[model samples]
Target: MGNAQDKPPGTGGGGGRSDQATAGSGARGRAGGSAEKAQTHKASEKRVANGRENSPAGGQGQQGSPAVDTSYLDAPSGALPPHLARLKNEGNHLFKHGQFGDALEKYTHAIDGCAEAGIDSPEDLCILYSNRAACYLKDGNSTDCIQDCTKALELQPYSLKALLRRAIAYESLERYRKAYVDYKTVLQIDTGVQAAHDSVHRITKMLIEQDGPGWRENLPDIPAVPLSVQQHHREKPISVEVAQARAARAAQEEVRKKEACFTLLKREGNDLVKKGHFQEALQKYNECLSLKSDECALYTNRAICFLKLNHFEEAKQDCDSALQLEPSNKKAFYRRALAYKGLQDYLSASSDLQEVLQLDPNVREAEQELEVVTGLLRQSLMDSSAHTPRV
Candidate 1:
């Protein structure tokens, strides 16, 4: 975001000499005429000097005459015209000095020159627009900033600077949604931009509050970042500290996404359980456990699904796991008791039910179930004794 101005290529020039002595004599003779006549003579002499400088035959000429400054007549190969390049360089200098207004004028002049001269170099034009956009942003003219940035982007779609500038402009204008999209897109292009990461995080909360859970559906289409842009970013040089920070931020973002996914799956599992869709709930819980295997709630929640599905062994296993994580969980104890009863293990059922009561004595359901289980146990023992042979 600093400066955001484009640097112009270096200018070069060839030397030439002009016979200004003759022009000077003529000007002296015409001094009695209108000032316009003398001015025209001076301009003609300057043009002659420029023409001689550009001529292939022109070199150090007639021994004693002073050389004319013909540097303005030449531009670097494959660069913008000297006049336009000068404007751009001036703009960059002005921008660095915090003269944004003057910089804006210079960029505008360069852009106009490009149009007049039919200089259709997209890269050059894009830079001019982007530099001007920087000026607009500095001046707090966000609307103009957006417009210039858009123009720059149109000329060079993958312009990182223009995209960042436009995103800042959008945020300043309170167009949070667009700003968010641009910031996300910027990260896709170059993940090292901490500002984009921060802005995305800030805007995401605002959007979620404004549009509810379906906020993403209301956003504009975010274009996929090109692979070339990614490669370019990778090849770009960065400081060691910046690289380390970027990697750390990337890891944190990954964990945040994983946790968010886990929460969503857990919620969906709970909802499915409430709706009596035990199998679907089981699938959801399975995914949640994959993401967070040590979560006791996930095991307990899955145990309910297994119990509802009459998978007594699986239910008992899940309950056992939950208890291993939380020994005093009344729900785990009660659910395990139910699972044992389903397996026709009355003794184990009775033991788990008693444990549940020990943990939470006010659980009336456990008290009733324990009473029934104890009576069954007593009857089974008496019947066994009555039927016993000579052992």
Candidate 2:
């Protein structure tokens, strides 16, 4: 697929939400603070095994184009002190070799080198801070990463690196307003910073035109999010804390509709099962499981797939898991009995059906099955009695 940046124009409608998502491994509950998930056509383990470089969002990094706003924060065409020059060369070398770890160390030394040498001008400090911020980002220390970028902004207000990195950080935090402000700042720095320009334009369109809850109290009337970023955000799970926070925000705004992405995913899995794509259906069901383990339907559906695949042991295990997560799931009990039956473990199956009837006395299938088993057990007892004759 083309890079997100290379995509043809899309109507920048709505605040960024997307339908497409990657599902992987067993789905976890949507506890909601910045939890990211993906779609799964392939098993997560298989997908990871076929992988390359790591990114924060758990995908391949996009190649970054040259910053158009580079001119916005260059040191004023003057000679740099010798130590600063040497530090710059060393840092650049490490960064170029993809040695982000060592490069990070070098940048830290460079920052210390500047302080010891009294090279603390705002413009110079801003550049140092920005370079170091990149190192922190490469390390996945986004909290510190954004702080450094903010420091760069304090020094060089128009610094594109600072603006963009701050936006990146805010997005990582799911703080759309602050991110939008930083993006907007890029435009004021220069209109030619087309990536930021394009990003700002796109984000604005998404917030205002593309998705709901697009407005922010912090910035000028910019749309505030990229279409692709919004699309990525859609269906993405957050830690419980973050989801609650976002829920609070939307509730106050009275904007977003009822949340059902997990339910939606589970429903899709059900549809897949109906088409007899057992493995594929399990993937979808497992994806839902990852989002909300408490979701009774996810476990039941996945167990159904296991049963269809004739993996009775696995089906029973899935039922056990589902019932633990949702004790009231009658379907789990019904299926657990069937799994036992498939394994010819009639006693266990009878116990399960007994539980099913307890949960739903009107279930005719459970009643009929229970009666049949009971009759067989009685006949066996009578036959054994006859065989023990005179003993």
Candidate 3:
């Protein structure tokens, strides 16, 4: 998460400064010192607590010197709404004290307060969500961290902090492609950012090692920030609250359309598979997966095509991804069994087939596969034993 340690500065936490100079000087100036003088001296011995300095510095100035001013105790935060400011202040306090859970709760309350007041400025929302993303990262909830950063980006796409946080979360999840894209976008927006530049180089090297040098050539383009929305805000200048609400709805609708296209692509992939066009089906499934990586059915279907093409390793990887998304998916287990069988891994094949059967005892395909694998294992063991010399 982008510099998650940079929390909003705490406010209203500085207690009133003690009148140090006056008290200390009076104690030192006392004459005929006795029990009362000693008691006064003891009472006057004070040090500013919590790192707060006594405002009016030094003792009452010499007769002709100018008086020290300590009137700026209530620091002005320049027109920030009181409720929102208070929430951030409290959240920052909790965050500094390692109370991340409580800090998140305070940040959430601030978000709700903004909504209730119809204050939906992307700038305001982005800060709140980004701060909350920091808390989620601290709590080791990278998924939620990504979600909050995404929300912040939807409001303010050019927010480098939000983009950086999202990239960090994606990297944590091993989604290297997504993280690389985000880092690239950050570099595009601000070429001077060393972190983004370093991240791009690091992730590029990793991608090369994982997928070979050609991987960079196939990477998707970095996404452009929607600065036009911010510009339009200035030009047309609708009520901020109304504009923010409208923007949110429009973004949601766009997401719905994207999901609909994802479903359509999946259906097309299924049709291609049915027609025995395994290569075309693979392409379609890949496209669907690009839009919805968490779809267990899509991954399983892709594994089916890989198996048809005799790409046992690729088929196993796809089945593994599907099972990661859905551990209970019998189809994934069965498909993986096929993959293992293709690779002549009778032991693993038998295990997966057994799991499939356990999940669905009525599955005839799994039952038959399990029997075949069991016999192969037994025959292989017997062959090995037959070749062994007596000891």
Candidate 4:
């Protein structure tokens, strides 16, 4: 009974072991096939989603597949996704190298990704739009540039770069009035932007020629910059060189304005003098002098006003100031002579007339006045001697 139960060891036991090994191998083979099929399906889906299936190189082997960018997958949580950041950086790099078309594509991809990701960050969106607008501008697509710039402005109002780019686009489109308004708004936001200042001037000339004196009325109302934006610009750090340049430009602008005001006032004063409105002319001259205190011509012109008004002392003082500024000013010498005559100082008047003649012998008025003053001085001296008692 024991020998029957044991069987032959090699025949039964060895055969049993062999059958178990075969079964286990088959199970593993089937599982491996399923895993390989799943992997192939996943790779196919990725290629389809990336739109590479129909690409010219897609028919090639795996080596022809587009390089996968898995950098975003390793991004740390709670920060801007690595993919978006990478796109922006690559766009900037391309733009710096003057590959505007390529940069534009990069920015477009990033913008679309942001939209799909539901990113609503105003500052980030604004920068992307503005950058795209710059690319459009470079491509000579004014319409698209304006649209992108407008979108940027809407996202971040008072954006200086957006306003400037939009203004340029509008000008390129021959929308002069809108361009003028946008440039003006840019200046209000940042007076230091020389490009904005120049654009405003150029557009103003175009608008004036197009719409005449009513150009301003035809312009769209300019929006006021928010206080927050103004404060932000004011508080922003600037390099030393930039700060110096800005200060120099501001000083030059101030000088230009003052000179213009001085010219206008001086012209008005001269007109009033021609009309014999001496008092009003004197007021205008005073304003002119206030604007240009060191101007020798201003002092001489004001002295004429004083003389016409019969303010002899004031006229004399103005002539004195004019002479101090220009020692050989013929106008000052002649005017001072008239002032002395008005004050009944015949001796001083005669001496000033001689000085005027010495400066310019062709001054007929001075020659005539000298004769009259000489006669008065001689008569006064004789009268004084006649009134003197014997000593």
Q: What is the lDDT of residue 69 in candidate 4?
A: 45
lDDT of 4 by residue, 42-141 (tens): 4533543453433222222366666644343233322346666655665665566576665665566556657657788888888877887776676666
lDDT value, residue 209 of candidate 2: 52
Model 4 stretches astray by more than 4 angstroms: 1-192, 197-246
What TM-score goes with each of the models? 0.45, 0.37, 0.41, 0.47
lDDT of 2 by residue, 127-160 (tens): 7667766655555555655777877878766566
Which regions of candidate 1 deviate over 4 angstroms? 1-192, 196-234, 237-239
- lDDT by residue for model 3 over 286-386, one digit each (tens)? 99988888889998999999999999999999999999999999999999999999998999999999898888899998888898999998998899899
Please report the TM-score between candidate 3 and the true structure: 0.41
Q: Specify the highest-lDDT model's number.
A: 1
lDDT for residue 242 in candidate 1, whole number 0-100: 64
Residue 232, candidate 2: Cα error in Å is 28
lDDT tens readout by residue for model 1, 238-264: 756566777888899999999999999
Lowest summed-lDDT stretch of 10 residues in model 2?
23-32
lDDT, each prediction: 0.75, 0.60, 0.70, 0.72
Q: What is the RMSD of candidate 2?
A: 20.9
RMSD of 4: 24.6
